[model samples]
Target: MSTGPLNPETSTSLPSPPFVHLKGIPNFRDLGGYKVAGSDLIVRRGYAFRCGEPTSATPEAIETIRGLGINHIFDLRSLPEIQKMQVAGTGPKTVDWPGVTRVFTPVFREESYDPVSLAKRHADYQSEGSEGMVNAYRTILTEGANSYSIILRHILEDARRSKNTAETALIFHCTAGKDRTGVLGALLLSLCGVPDEVVAEEYNLTEAGLGEWTELLVQAVLKQGAASEEGARRMVGARKDSMINTLAMLRDEFGGPENYIVTKCGLTEAEVAEIRHFLVVGE
Candidate 1:
């Protein structure tokens, strides 16, 4: 994996496919193709992607993505997330790409609100919807465990694609690809038998990988009249506490990661067995 901006010509030589970059889309890269769990085979290159709000994708950007043979698009943004961060352009609103599958994974919906906004704007989720936000958070406590199921669905689709020679790649994302996407990444890596430290390291990479961008985000926000350190802090982070908390939540609900998948995520042991059989590179 070349850890740099992918130039169209030089990218062909990359260990994994060159990262698919668009001027407007941030963090669009393959999560597969990394050395993990002692397997020579990694997640198939060009199969999985993590990106920020893609509403800004230009015609060229969409063309590049289409060229990558994306079979499915798993959108992790909440309804409000999409609305708030409206991509610059609009297209035929269809999840079904000509040869792809589209899935919407919303942790929070448009109606939900979190009073705490970034320090810069001093904005709150209040305008979005007060009770909806509270209800959404409560639902997370009670049903947050359900995300595992949604994730499993996407992976199963990936596994199925791998089995069939059809486009066997899937890309998933949330707004920043840090929290929602981060947890899903953690779950998948852990299931592949990657160590917690490795997972943590991968999670932490967000700060380094996105640090410059985070700074730019702060500057952009300030240019928009947001002047708060909290906003800046929020931009440059893989919040340790949030990561730890999510892990704790998983442990508390499911005896282990596997249990979380089978019991909580709606995957039977056999189903998970199928996923492992197809998706994992090595035993």
Candidate 2:
């Protein structure tokens, strides 16, 4: 309900202050220090991050990630997705940060795929159109809400365990850190009544920050005469209109993200309160 850019003075920039552009990771970024709507409360900087895997990152990039002071990681990749990346639990497995915990929450079970074929099938389906993307968002809002209870619980429990500590950060990721993670971020902020434009701005940053691999996906599709780079870009990117449609779907089907979580995902208001207490600072 409020309209204001996050204060320029308090905003931090490090070329990657909010995101270290790992060579292999597409659109990895810090989710921190944003002012919460209708209140002085802000989402604390460095307390949470979202990104793809770090397997192929250079040693310097790895150190840069460690220097972010991240103490917890929640990997949302399916088992096969991790295996295909071949970076599962490898290079950036665990930094020297004491008490760091790694938790795995597969967005889809391994059984959901016929390992040899599903990845390519997913890629083909995703390359299709507004419908595929819209359905993806709808699936996310409906089934994807289920993942939040676990993530929210981890955040709450981690914060409780780390009380009075210097700082703790949790990073959540699926393969691209775009669709699944993006939905989670959008829903959490929406529940707080963050304006649609602000939420869209954050969601669309993934496109602005896309690394070479993302570019390659666009190029590959273009080379095949499937679409122009511009068109392909549009296909892979999140758009405001699509988000609105997805919200409409949520409203019609689940009544909204918060209600979907409560009624469908089984997250009680008490748990939601604890999540707010732990993550949304100064509330």
Candidate 3:
């Protein structure tokens, strides 16, 4: 995969189709077309996406999202974040995209860290360096297993009954789509037999997608009293090592993503098999 912004011209060569670009929506991509290791199977294209919050999605972008045939949207944002960003007069607790089912499965409680406070806290911790980021990722894995499990079950059940059509597409997102979304994307791909290196590479792509916004985010943090400019900059950027370390911890402590899902998330072996069956297509 090219380590740069997804170029539609050369998208044919990509592991997945070119990422869908929506004005004001960052870090959005089709999570398909990856070849499974040691097998002839590949993840089916157009069935799933990973993205950042679409609170600022333009009218055209909303149409584009609808056109993608996404019937299910798994929002991972805390309630406070949703309350703060949801468009007024649309609906309470959901984006007013007609014909789409939006599920609010927050990985973290609103009281733990709402979107407004998380940015400031992220800046503070990130200023200290990677340790803060590493700790955050660890917490997502250990403390957020129930939410992850719920997400997995939704995907599994959806895929199991899907007609293998684009209309069955599912997407999940957080505020920035770099941390929480990255972790879930990593977990899903890792569970499907993608190598850890490839998983980390995918996680790092968020930097390319969100590079401009990252600067703006860092500046916002600085204005809000980050300890240092350099620290805020470090916090705003994505690092392969952070995700690499998280995966390593998963391996060392839980055996692998499957085990973690089974033990931590309480998914059964049969359900895991069902998910693999629906997602991995042999060509």
Candidate 4:
């Protein structure tokens, strides 16, 4: 694995380049590049990434992900989703990269949201529109808090132990890489001191990044008679208002990301501090 920086000149003072594009992988991007609010720090690039399932990743794309030097992968997909990826021969397979450590942290369990139930849920999304998606986000925060807590703790521990090198980098993802991944990404950025607006903006980027696939997903839902065209669009697209409302809900219910992490997610204050300490870096 190459140990050098992907872009040596990139730093907190300068904007990072565009996300590394990997064919067959939707919504793949570094979690870096944002300047932490109220500090001279920035999220160190190449150390963290977020993406959709990689089951269909081309050989070249797989090589590219491998080249990212990721050591830990936190998969937030449901069991059915993971199985679909496995059966379809898409996404990252541990066998493909023996050196990487992959952890299956399904946000929704098999019994709770199996494939048939998930399909029904998607249909519900069609009628519910963005409101449905918002409710889903809430469910993730409330019901999936334990899974998220584990993910956050693992990331904190990895960041703490790693020497801040590419080889120690961590990547996390869900199926769409928007909803579940978005919420976790938002929380992490918020913990690193990024403002809610920036966090929402980052979340919104998924609409553009996954535009083509989003369209296909919406079409699929529509074809299944799960939702109206408008409903399907709302369900598949990543809207800023959805994240904005979710963050507001986070504040109203849990007081903010820190409180949510400590109270709802069961992370300690020290672990939270360690996250900021290890992930945020000064120029």
Q: Best candidate per TM-score, number? A: 3
**Per-candidate RMSD, Å:** 7.5, 8.0, 5.8, 6.9
**lDDT for each candidate structure:** 0.53, 0.58, 0.70, 0.68
TM-score to true structure, per model: 0.69, 0.75, 0.83, 0.83
Displacement of residue 7 (Cα, Å) in model 3 is 21
Q: What is the lDDT of residue 172 in candidate 1?
A: 74
lDDT of 4 by residue, 1-283 (tens): 1111111111122223435676666677888878999878987777789876655566677677778787678887776555544222343243245557778777787632321234466545544435666677788888778888888887777766774543467778776678788888988888788887888888887776663565556655555455467766766667777788888888888788889999988988898887777778865
lDDT tens per residue, model 3, 1-283: 1111221111222333437777656668887778789988887777788876665566777788788888778887777666554212122345567777888778876732422345566643554445667767777788778888888998887766773643477788876677778888888888888878878888887766664566556665566566777766666667877788888888888788889999999999889877877777866
Count of backbone collisions within predicted model 4: 6
What local lDDT does model 1 show for residue 283?
12
Clashing pairs in 3: none
Ranking by TM-score: 3, 4, 2, 1
In model 4, how large is the Cα lDDT of residue 279? 76
Q: Is candidate 3 or candidate 4 better by lDDT?
A: 3
Whole-model lDDT, model 4 = 0.68
Model 2, span 1-283: residue lDDT tens: 1111111111123245566655445567877656678788866567778875544455555555667776677766666655544222232242233455667766664622211222233443345345556676675565555566678777667667866342656778765567778877777666655666777777777655554445554544444444345655665566766666666676688777668778876877776665665556763
Clashing pairs in 4: 54-90, 54-91, 55-90, 55-91, 56-90, 56-91
Error of 4 at 107 (Å): 0.5
For model 2, what is the error of residue 61's alpha carbon versus the real structure, in angstroms, after optimal superposition?
3.0
In candidate 1, stretches whose alpha carbon ends up further than 4 angstroms from where it belongs are: 1-19, 38-41, 86-98, 110-148, 164-166, 208-213, 216-236, 239-249
lDDT of 4 at 201: 86
Candidate 2 backbone clash number: 0
